[model samples]
Target chain A: MYTSIAGSVARPSEVRLQSPRPSIPPSTAQPEPVGSAFADLTVCRHSVTMSDPRAAIVPAPAAARATDVAIELLAEMGQDFAGSRSIGETLRRALHRIVDHLDAAGGALFLLEDDGRTLLCTASVGATNIEGIRVPVDRGIVGRSVRSGRGELVGDVRTDPEFFQAVDERTGFVTRSILSAPMSVRDERLGAIELVNKRGEDPHFTPEDLRILEAMAASAALAIVNARLAAALVEQERVRRELELAAEIQRSLLPTPPRAGFPVVGINVPADVVSGDFYDFFELADGRILFNLGDVAGKGMNAALLMAKTASLFRCLGKTVHRPGALLARIDAEIAETATRGMFVTMVAGILNPATGEICFANAGHEPPLLHRDNGTFQAFPADHPPLGIAEGSADTPLPEATVHLDGGTFYVVSDGVTEGLTVGGAPLGVEGLQDILREAGRLPPAERLTAVTSVLTAGPRPLHDDATVLAVVGGSAVTRPRSGSAAGRREPASEELVRVSVPSCADRLRLLRQVVALSATQSGCCQEAADELVLAVDEACQNIIRHAYHGDPTGQIELSVHHQGRDLIVLLRDYAPPVDVSRIKPRDLGDLRPGGLGTHLIRALTNRAEFLPTPPGGGTLLKLVKRIR
Target chain B: MNTGMTHRVERRQTGMVVVALEGDVDLQSSPEARRVLLDAVAHGGAVVVDLSKVGYIDSSGIASLVEALQKARQGGSRLVLAAVSDAAMRVLQLARLDRVFVIHPSLEAAITGDR
Candidate 1:
């Protein structure tokens, strides 16, 4: 009995413990009274329990005092685990504490694997020779306990059918009288713990040994659960990193709002990593543009994926040929073949010809759109077919083309989310309401109109119920007149004020002249576009001065001036030379880009009066060219 | 019409267009320069609007010029500035208009230089 309790001797001398040994004759040590409390000696510090050595021996008087001692040891180990950051190492130390503090021969800790299939033996104690040994659920006693979820004590190993003798062969030890218990947590069987043999024994494990094994298994299970949860957290972090990377790639694909050139202007906003809503414009052959605005019926990365697919499909179609209605019908068929089978899109595909200001669109079950006219009126056009993918040959329900003329007027298309968008209060800005805002802003410049849309959306600051998208196009008459300044007919200076600026060549002279003329139109102070004819006349005269007078070498400096008479701007020019010989002057020789003759005629054609005089005491000539702006 | 605070913008054809100033032209009236510049090109014979009496020209003044430049580009016209008041000049120089405009020593000089 004495040698068996220490564990080291019994593992080797498993059968030898059958000989009853009276160690320290019972009389020498006073017979201690039985325990006052039969409760297991396993103690708990802050609800953390420990192994009880005297669990099988339930004499009341003796157990109470032993329980006190076991609890004290458990409290110390609890403090150690709390301070440890390393979960695996902490569990290892915890298992070792159970073996050292309790009278167990050995113990093993098993954790549930992520796949939930295997019980991993991570930490062990009293395992001197074999530490790396893993017991599969199909292998040994440990496996059976987990499968049955019941503790098993084989009093004699040789006679027990549940005993798997291979471990003994591997460890070079003869194990006997085993006590083991299953570690269970919320219906999940983690693993089992086994104490090989009792130390002080009549060669068999007692209920006390089994009780201690159960307690140790419980502690191991808790630690394993915590570690498993931590592993799951790290996996989620990895998934998040992948999502962020994908989001960045997709965001770069969207085009920025271009400076609305001749005819068109549009805007788009994705709801998430990918948008179910998308708009695209790609140039096709012969000044024909392929364009589309589509809405996928879903959310998140899935919808974004669908949107990308839809966009690429159209791009492919555009590459082969440019047909509006037929292409949309093909796309509808394609959508049915590919993409999420049940999902669909409401799309409008078209071809735009800026030179002719014509757009042929196939509207396939999208929101009804509004076209703003140049006469300050609006027209709403609705859908004909069901959304694409839901119906085949549905585009055959031909939507009569609402061909409205576009001349410096805007057209707006929106998803239901846009018009249905409400204030923090319950006021939903519906089609008419939205039309009101657009109409009010219709008179505004194109840039301001776009800004107004942003402001309108921002009105709903937080918790937007759904995604909103606004696409606006201004067609034809994209030529916006100068609103801030007018260059009607600004003339040259009457009193002859002119600043000399170096010109590089005749080509540069025209450009520089344009620059100076533009600057004068803006800064020359009277009123913008003050005098239409005079400014045109002065510009023609200046061109004449550059072409005919200087031959446009672009090397010399050209002077500028703005002379006025009671709000009128008249221009004058002077050069250090003689007056022009009026009769000999001929028109331009276009053969090699020379000037003078044509320029003077053009000057005569544009200006009110023209004259030339000799420069004061110099070889240069002083020329006068005048026009009125105010 | 209340020409308000005048700004004598210079010209490419002539030297400067004298725009007279008579009111408290602040941020509200600053873009008026753009309006005035555009109007002057169309009507301003060849003269600079004088801003010597303008009490204050703030950041809005910079904005006004930028607006004027945009308008000129759209209309294919010329725009310039002649004389800036000392206070306005200090503000303008700080804002770098001295680097942007013709910025003559005086309005008359701007005109004479053009001649």
Candidate 2:
């Protein structure tokens, strides 16, 4: 009876599974006792016999047998799947179990591709190197089952119009019957599971077989979803760490606030983890301060990197180019050669002379900075050329510069984020709004004024969409006049008769020493030439202590005292550094042609008498410089 | 007044390039001064850097001038410093580089290769 059943379903040249021995091979078979729960799960062979007349009619016992086999197969698959290390491995094991349990000739598991228009065969059983085969998502019976989220059972390829024969033609296999089910987790269809050519006498698949295959597919789908989610989470974590590092590097690149008496303050706030805005204020060796504000074209890591590079270039070039227009031209040429296409920088650079209240500024496609005059009015100096990195070569027209006298006034530079910030009503705070804010806070000092503007701009609950940067330069108080005026032309004595200060031996403090010396010399009735020479002598003495006696150690303290004697103006400098070798302190030969070791020479040349003596009750150096008051 | 340092390069009728540098050549202004001086050296002719207006110079400024001197030698040309300011000359004397280069009292003297 079984022989006739097997012969009736066999095709001309199709590989058949030899069955009726045990359902699963002994190597993979599990022990089952008689009358156990899985006893009804004996492999069913379709045949015409006294007890069963129709081969396709699944009776109550046959239905029970299919359910029992599906349950046992699933239990075993769960264990093996849990032990699998990779997604491919899990899918491979699942496909093997499905083909073995259903007694099908072969099976393949197809997964959705990233494009979502095609399915790639990720794992396959009974096929040699057929992995990575791709088929259109809507092309075959497998595609139909995936689309409908249902199982398809086709008894014969010739009778089923939806059956796609291309796979068979490609793989050189003949298809007799097929059972395919969509693998879906919740509402998302991941892919499809397809089994082909049921083996033994049961070439035709029953509805019961389709039901069992569907249950297996559901389990496989759940595993696939879990793996993909794990992968996505890892990728997210990696990106987060990279952004954190980028933010740290950006923060380190920001410049520190300028010292007191510099009349400059700057602030920056990023809209995201990193900002593309930067500002800097540093004093040049010529007593002029160089200040700048810049904004890169975009946000995030790329923008942050470009901002750092642009700022560094400005700092290095700013030291060389005193004219703001010439500096911008050089920066533009450098950016054009090094910056990526489509990326550029908008910047405003200027040099401020505090004593004379003179400022020379150049703008490059940036927002016009507002110059608040002492007369309660503001003027905007707009860009004269495009932003840097956008054009090749130097600007056609000389980068126009605006010279403004900033006595008792302020200069403000802001990024676009200030004007484009949204309010509660979703309206942008235009440039006029920014001007109003500045005007209201104009009464406050430069640093406090910057704080007031920031609070108002970022007050709304809605976060800013970009980086906001503000730089302000306020003019110094009207105290020191230009050194060009001769002291003999003055009508009044200096404001102070005596001045003394104790400060750390640092290069930055030399300016303070010069101020005190100039005051004392003027009060003593010394002419401008004599007073200037007195100040230079004292400055050179302090520099020697800072550089030579202290070896550039800022922790060392220097005491400066300036006073007028009966016929001599005297300046005394004392430091607690190691005692100097007075014998070896002679100035270098003037005929020698090199740099350095000039502090002693300048001090001696400018002062009537410069004497180096030891401090009382201590091991330190005390320098006394004097000039006759005529 | 424009107190900031400035430079200009001129080609003399005698085929010598004269780079006139004005202002203080300290740490802040050495880079620009370097560029101007080096360009004169690269032009491959007798170069004279006129420092008549330079009132001050630091070690960094001297280093730039030395670089110009080296470049002039590599290009097989003469480099001379003219009208050296007292302040700048003192620094050059201290560093002992004053003996290395040809020094002249004025631009005309440098152009004529006078001592």
Top of the candidates by TM-score: 2
Q: Compose the digit string of candidate 2's lDDT tens values, residues B1-115.
A: 2324688899877778999888765434666888888888888888998989986555556768888888888888889999998867865664566788789998888887632
Best of the candidates, DockQ: 2
Write one digit per residue (lDDT tens) for candidate 2, span A502-536: 99887656655666787788878998777767776
Indicate the TM-score of model 1. 0.45
Candidates, DockQ: 0.02, 0.07
| Candidate 1 residue lDDT tens string, A99-217 | 66555567666654556556676777774544556656765677777888877788787887767777688777777767777877779877776667666546566554455556556
Stretch of 10 with least lDDT, candidate 2 chain A: A11-20
Q: What TM-score number comes out for model 2?
A: 0.55
Clashes of each: 110, 8
Q: What is the lDDT of every predicted structure here?
A: 0.55, 0.74
Give DockQ: model 1.
Answer: 0.02
Candidate 2 regions off by >4 Å?
A1-69, A72-85, A114-116, A258-262, A300-302, A395-398, A443-445, A478-630, B1-115
